[model samples]
Target: MPWEKQFDIDEVLEKAMTAFWHRGYTATSMQDLVECTGVNRASLYATYGGKRDLFIAALKAYDESGRQALFAKLEALDDPKEAIHRLFWPMRPWHPGLVSCVAVS
Candidate 1:
């Protein structure tokens, strides 16, 4: 039988992304990914190939999420200026916190 993954891939990627976001790709180790994602080293390797692959996946996921959020905001708002403003300045009071763009960083 094929092996089944015991953890959520999305959750793991999110955690891994957070780890990379805070520490950066060079600074974050496989051990850190395991600790942050609650996944074993072997599993992470098997699932994501390696740290670079995992980082790419995480970055893609982050970008997709940001795009979706931006589209949702744009769709909901009637004013184009408000949508543009929100996109440019994400740290507005309504937002929970600042999320620096991970793709650029």
Candidate 2:
């Protein structure tokens, strides 16, 4: 039955990564990951060796992706101040996306 369970690891990782990134480690439940990734609990446990391991992997993946994106912008801008400004410029928009993760401040 091993071959029958042909789930894509990358897709699952990406889904899990988004869930973790959005909700953070302390708030994200195992059920949340299962729902987000569209995989059963057992499959998730077996594939990634529980929530912590999966979260670690997902964080690494996300960090690598963010680093690459920042590197590209830095290369294009050349100026450190401009690069920093460019990196944070997109976040200045009044989007509801960051509201969920923001604490009362």
Candidate 3:
């Protein structure tokens, strides 16, 4: 039979995603994931199949979140240039932080 735990998978993944997003895959340790997700190491390993797999999942989640956020922001604006600027400009300063999660190797 399947068992249930205190952790919410989506919520945990969201946090893990953010952590991996802010810190690169090679930089984020299992301890970091436990601390960020409030879930233990065993759970992380069992569910995500170690750090690499978890990071890949997190990166996918982060990318989906980014695309959704961008779509929403772009849809809200009437001017295409302004929308593009708003979506892309803030990236310059935080590019490293946001783009680092995409590393799956």
Candidate 4:
């Protein structure tokens, strides 16, 4: 019998990422992840491995989002120069939280 419960991975990742972003990797504990991600300790370990594993997953998810946005900008073929310019020089460039996360890695 499967004792596991169903959960939303995207929701868990979002919560875990926020916790890690706010607390930083060293300070964020497994208990914090459990509270923040709403995943039980045993299930968290079973599903995502350890804190390091979860951190890596969060970082990877963050990186992939940025990459996909960049690719979207690049794919706008209507005006290549403008698209490139927008990518490099947005009106409001870089989210403060995202910058901090980038600095950590």
Candidate 5:
């Protein structure tokens, strides 16, 4: 039988994305990814290729999730102006808790 993954890939990618978002790609090391993801380096490599590949995956995941959420919110609103306004000015402030967007830092 094929080796089974012990952890949730989505959860691991979310953690990895958060780590990269906070520390940036250059500052975040494999060890940091390992710790943040709670997955061993070997497993991460085997599952996601290398750090670069993992970063790309994380970025894609972020973009897809953001788009889905935006669509859902926009679809719920009847007024185009309200949708545009809400898109530009969210109800809540951007912070770690909200994970509003991908930060350069």
Candidate 6:
């Protein structure tokens, strides 16, 4: 029988995205995605093809979300500098909930 996924894909992608964001593409393992997203290996493989494909999906999702957020902020601001500030202000290294993919010096 084909395994049915009983979870939200966005939620899984967010978890998987965070995992990939926290750990780089190379360092992140299939088991790690399974643990973080609550999606089993078989389901992940079934849905996203594999870790690489899943990572690509997660990355595309991340970009889309980030782009939308930035655009919304920029649309509200008249000044370029302020818009730039608004765009980048929330992003910071070691944010309370964010994990770095690579160590920053």
lDDT of 1 by residue, 1-105 (tens): 979999999999899999999999999999999999999999999999999999999999999999898799788999988876777675556545755545435
**Full ranking by TM-score:** 5, 1, 4, 6, 3, 2
- Predicted structure 3: lDDT: 0.82
lDDT (tens digit, per residue) of candidate 4 on 34-59: 99887899999988899999999888
Candidate 2: tens digits of C-alpha lDDT, residues 1-105:
464566788788899988988999889999999899999999888877999999988878778888998888688976888876776667758564564324323
Off by over 4 Å in 3: 21-23, 77-105
Query: Which portions of model 5 miss their true places by more than 4 Å?
Result: 80-105
Error of 3 at 83 (Å): 6.4
Cα RMSD (angstroms) for every candidate in the order listed: 7.0, 8.0, 7.1, 6.8, 7.6, 8.3
With a 3 Å backbone cut-off (N, CA, C), the pairs that clash in candidate 4 are none
Give one clash count per candidate, in the order shown. Answer: 0, 0, 0, 0, 0, 0
| Model 2 C-alpha lDDT versus the unseen true structure | 0.83
Clash count, predicted structure 1: 0
Best by lDDT: 1
lDDT agreement with native, every candidate: 0.90, 0.83, 0.82, 0.83, 0.89, 0.85
lDDT of 3 by residue, 5-104 (tens): 7788878888988887788777999999999999999988889999988878877877898899979979999998898677666756866556433442
Residue ranges of candidate 1 with Cα displaced over 4 Å: 79-105
| Residue-level error in angstroms, candidate 1, position 21 | 1.0
68: Cα error in model 5, Å: 1.1
Question: Over 4 Å off in model 2, which ranges?
Answer: 1-5, 77-105
Model 2: lDDT of residue 101: 24
Q: After superposition, how far is residue 94 of candidate 5 from its true place, in Å?
A: 16
> All candidates' TM-scores?
0.75, 0.60, 0.62, 0.73, 0.75, 0.68
